[model samples]
Each structure stands twice: as C-alpha cells, then as structure tokens.
Target: MDFILLSILKTAIAAPVLLGTLAYLVWIERKVLAHVQLRIGPSRVGPHGLLQPIADAIKLLTKEDFIPSYVNKFYYWLAPWLALMFAVTAISVIPVGPVVEVFGIKTNMGQADISIGLLLILGLTGMGVYGIALAGWSSNNKYSLLGGLRSSAQMIAYELPMAMAIASPLLIVNTLNLREIVNAQAGYTFGIVPNWNVLGGGLQIFSFIIYLICAFAETNRIPFDLPEAENELVSGYNTEYSSMKFAAFFMAEYCNIITACSVATTLFLGGWHPIIPNELGGQFLPTLICMFFAGVLFYHALNPSRPSDRLSMGVIGAVILGLGLMFQVPVVKDLAQPLFWFASKAGFLIFFFIWVRGTVPRFRYDQLMRFAWLFLFPAALLNLLVTAFIVAVKSN
Candidate 1:
C-alpha cells in the first residue's frame, strides 16, 4: 500500500512537470528559430519571452472547441489522450539522477527503475503511433489519412536503427536498468577522463550517432516532420481538431520530443551526469551543467541550420553551471563528472541532429521506405552481429 501510494504521488508530481516542460520546449523552439532567422522571439512576454509558453497555454485553453460532423467521435476523443499517455508513461523508466535519502526514505528522480527500461520505452513509442494513426482514420479526411499513413510508416522505418543504437549500451553494461548503466560510468581513470560508454570501443560513438539520428525521426521533428508538414498536409493528422482536443495533440508531440531526448540522454550520453568533476561536487554541478547542456542540445537538434546564437547561450550557461559544481567539496566532486561528460556528449549529438535536419532534405515516401529497409536495417543487423562477436571474444 505504501509503495503504491508513493508511486501515485510520483506520477501526480511528474504530470504537471512534464506538461510544463513540453510547453517550455515549444517556447524554446520559437526562441531558437528567432535567433536562427536573425530576429528576436517572444520579447514582449516576460524577459526574452520566458512567459510566452504561459500565454500560449492560456490561448490554447480558451480557444473554441471544434468537432467535425463526419468524424468518429469516440476515436477522435481517445487519440490525443492516448498519445499523451504513452509518451508520459515512457518516462517512468528513465533514471534522471542518483538516489538521495530523504526522511529515512530513499527517492530517485525517475518514476520507476525497471530493469527493462529500454524495451519499455520502445514499447510505449510504438503505442504512440497507434494514437496518431487512429486520429487520422477517425477524421475521415484525405489530408488526415495521408498524414496518419506517413507517420505510421515513418515510425516503423526509424525504429530499426533506434533499437540497434540502444542495444550498444545494453551490450556493454549487460543490464536493462538505467541506474546500473549510470553506476557503471561513475568513476574516472588517469585522474581525468571519465569511464563512460561514449569513450569505450568505437561502438559507443557509432551507437550515439545512430541513436541521435533516429531520435529526430522518432520524435517527428523537422526534416523528418512530414506527417505535420504544414505546407504539404495543412496540419496533418489533427487538422480538423480544435480546442482542448487540438491542445492535447500539441502537448503530446512536445512530450514525445522530451521523452526522446531523455531516453537518448540515458542510453548513449548518460542521464543527468555531469561531464567534469565526478564525485567531487554534489547535485549542484550536475544539475546546472545537465540542464544547460540539455537546453542547448535540444535547441540545436531542433534547429541545426542556424544555431549559433542558441549554441552560444548554451556554452555560456554550461560554463556558469560548471563553475558552480567546481565550488563543491572534493568528496562529492567526482559525482559530477558523469554529468559533465553527459552534457558534452549529449550536446554534440543534439547539434548533430540539427545539422542533419538542416543539411538533408526530406525523404520521399518511397525513398524513406527504401532507406530504412536497405540501409538502416542492414546496418543495425551488422551492428548486432559485431557486438555479439566482440562480447564473446572479451569473455574468452
């Protein structure tokens, strides 16, 4: 009973934070784009548009609800909430930081510390696709149908490399729990470099690249954002949705983006771990650096073509945060090292995602289908084979 109550309490707390973070992500996207396009975004709302997300929330809430006459009412009503539910559920398995003892009870940042964290995330993501597809089918419109089909196909295709990328870390740690993975990389070597998987056999770097690329596609971000291609599909699957219904869909999309980043941060980059000063500083360094890096990486990944301003802000923020960590005592200083490396590596991958988004053009339906089938599928297979061989050799 106590554990169940605690789980419920955690879920309640996480719900609001997840919703607010999604809104803030949208605001940051706009701000990053403004910098990319050489214009200021959301200046009128608070300092540098800090309150812009709140304003948008209010506007979305008050908007009149619209329901198309021909639409399947029940399915239409169920789709958005389904999407949000699956997206949020994926977060339960993500371990954001180390456990802290509070009031004789230990609390971890994640909702749960399940061993099959990777599989659970993948499962929820697959479920999210169904909600998107159902929304289109229920709408009974050509555009919505087309968007739904496109998203369904795209997600299936990307799931290949994404799964393979996640497998690399599992290969190294030989466990499914995210907390175990972090613990594995807690220490430093040569009194300097951290012992993260990112620095391990060439597999780590390759896995990181694959995971980050697939993440963009999985989240349906720009470049791979064909489902919601405002120019092509007019608003995509949720085209006919309005009021809270549309807001639910919008929130779902942003939540998926954050979930994607968080999962990637945990798998390849190391979640909530600082880059420098491991165990040297306590939560101070890890929190500041991790947040700054996360913000920068997300912005860069979302807007790679023009991220100079956003990148600059991120670096400055990271430095300031790193300084805070440096001030902590040596006992906990080493603890912050994973966070520092985590930020640096995660930021690089996020920037890489942005660069790919900017440099590469969208794939045609057939091309997208073929690339997934021919390239990513075979590559992932090869990665799995090679990983197995190396593990066998190391054991022998």
Candidate 2:
C-alpha cells in the first residue's frame, strides 16, 4: 500500500511537470532559433514571453480538431497519443538523484528503479516508430506515407549505432540498471577530474560522441531530420494533424529530446554527480548560479524596458534569491543539490539540441541513411569493441 501510494504521488508530481516542460521547450527552441537569426522571439505574450507556452497551449486546445474524410480516423486519432505516451513512459527509469529520505520515506527521485532500465528505454524508444509510421499510413497521403517510411527506416538504421554506443559505456560499468551505471561513474581521479564514463571509465569519449550523434538522429533533430524535412515532405507525417493532436506530436518530440539527454547524462556525464567532488565545495555551486541569475534579474528590473518587467522581474528575482539562500541550509542542500546538478547537466544537453537545430541544415535522405550505416555504425562498433577489450584486460 505504501509503495503504491508513493508511486502515485510521484506520478502526480512528474506528469504535470513533464507536460509543462515540454510546452516550454518549444518556447525555448523558438527563442533560440530566433536569436540565431537576429530576431527578438516572443516578447509580447508575457514578460520576456514566459507566458507564451500557456498561450500556445490554449490556442492548440481550442483550435478545430479536424479529421479528413479520406483518412483512417482511428489510427489518426491514436498515433499522437501513442507517441506521447511512450516518450513520457521512458523517463520512469531515469534517476534524477540518489536515494533520499523525504519525511521518513526512503525513495529515489525517479519513478522506477528497474534492473534492466537501459533495455527498457531501448524497447520504449523502438516502439515509438510505430506511432509515426501509423500516422503517415493512415493519413492516405503520399507525402505522409513517404515521411512515415523514411522515419521508420531512419530509426532502424540509427538504432544499431546508438545501441552500440550505449553498450560501450555499459561494458565499463558492467550493469544494465541506469542508477548503477550512474553510480559507477561517481567520484573523481586525483581529486580533480570526474570519473564520468566519457573521461575515466573506459575513456569512452568517442563512444559518447557517437551516442550523441545517434541520439540526434533517433530524436529526428536537424542535420538528420530527413523524415520531416519541410521542403521535401510538406510537414511530413503529421501534416494532416491539427489542434491538440499536432500539439501531442510536438510534445512527444520534445519529451524524446529530454529523455535522450537525460539518458546521456546518466550514462556518460555522471547523473547528479557534481562536476567536482562534493568536498571541494561543488555543492555550493548551484546556490551560486541561482544567486547570479537572481542578480541579473534584479539588474534588468532596475532599468526595466517593459512596464511589466518592473514588477514581474523583481518578484521573480527575489524568489530566486530566497531559494538560493535556502540552499545554504543543511537539509535543503542535502535534498536539492543532487537535483540541481542533474538538471543543470541535462538542461545544457537540451540547449545543445536546440543549438544544433539552429545551426545545422537537414541532411538529404540518402546522405542520412548512408552516414548512419557507413560511418556512425562502424565507429560505434569499433568503440564498443575497444571498450570491451579494455575492460577484459583490466578484469584479468
């Protein structure tokens, strides 16, 4: 009963937060891309356009939920939800922090702690292809059908390299459990360099790079986004989708980006572990970062450009400052420090995803397939073989 209740409680917290993050991720992407093109993104929706996501959500929800007569209505209705469900479900096994006691209840920050967490993620992501394929085929449009086929083929081709890259780290860690993989990367060498998989464990830097490239391909992000190339496919599989269905597909894509980054963080970047050892005051870094942001907010508020910023920025800044101060308290620090580190690392990776979208051009379909098979797959396999050989020699 207790376990069930705790699980429910965690789900209640995680679900809403995940949805909100997905919405804001869109805003982040727009703002980033706009800046890259020398434009001010969304400034009118709210102070600094912080409320733009809420406005977008309302718009999507109220828009016409139109279904074409020629389309297979059932699968058209089912596909987006299916994509969103699997994308969000994969996060259950990703640990945000170490096990901690909250109000005398011992629990991990993540939802599930399954032994085969890595495999679970792989399976869920593999299943996600069905959603795109079904959406395309059911639409009864040539463009959508082609997009779906491309997506399916792309995922299949990339999974081999991604799996091999993922396996290289597992070879060094010797565990399928996500948390154990993270734990193995904890601590540092000579009290300076982190023992993260990329840096220390099997020195799998090339593996990490390959994994990231494969991740970009798997999530259908640019440079590898042939499946949804607007120029060629006319918005691809979900071109016929509108309103909340479209939003659901959008949400699924961002959720997958988050999941990919989180998995990478856990496998190679040291999930929740400080960049430096805790004894070296790494725990205080979060508080310092928050304080810096608070100071910047207050500075902008003092010379407010917009009328709303004078009040909104001031209040937000004060709240952030207060949170930063609270981190100085022992109990708060113990609870929040891990979360701060994990979020920081994951957030940077998410930003990287957006950055690449703004900077890179989509690859031609043939080029994408060829790169995956000829280059990424071979590189990943070589990295895995080398990592395994090193582990074997060390064990002996």
Q: How many pairs collide in each candidate, listed in order?
A: 24, 0
**lDDT of each residue in 40-144, candidate 1, tens digit only:** 878777646678889888888899878889999999989989988898788778776678544566777668988878788899988999888999899999999
| Candidate 2 Cα outliers beyond 4 Å, as residue runs | 305-308
TM-score, cand. 2 vs. native:
0.97
Tens-digit lDDT track of model 2 for 307-376: 8889999999999999888878887677788888898899999999989998988888888988999998
RMSD of each predicted structure: 6.2, 1.3
lDDT of candidate 2 vs native? 0.91
Instruction: List where candidate 1 sits over 4 angstroms from the true fold.
Output: 201-203, 279-360
Query: Where does candidate 2 clash, by residue pair?
Result: none
True lDDT of residue 181, candidate 2: 92
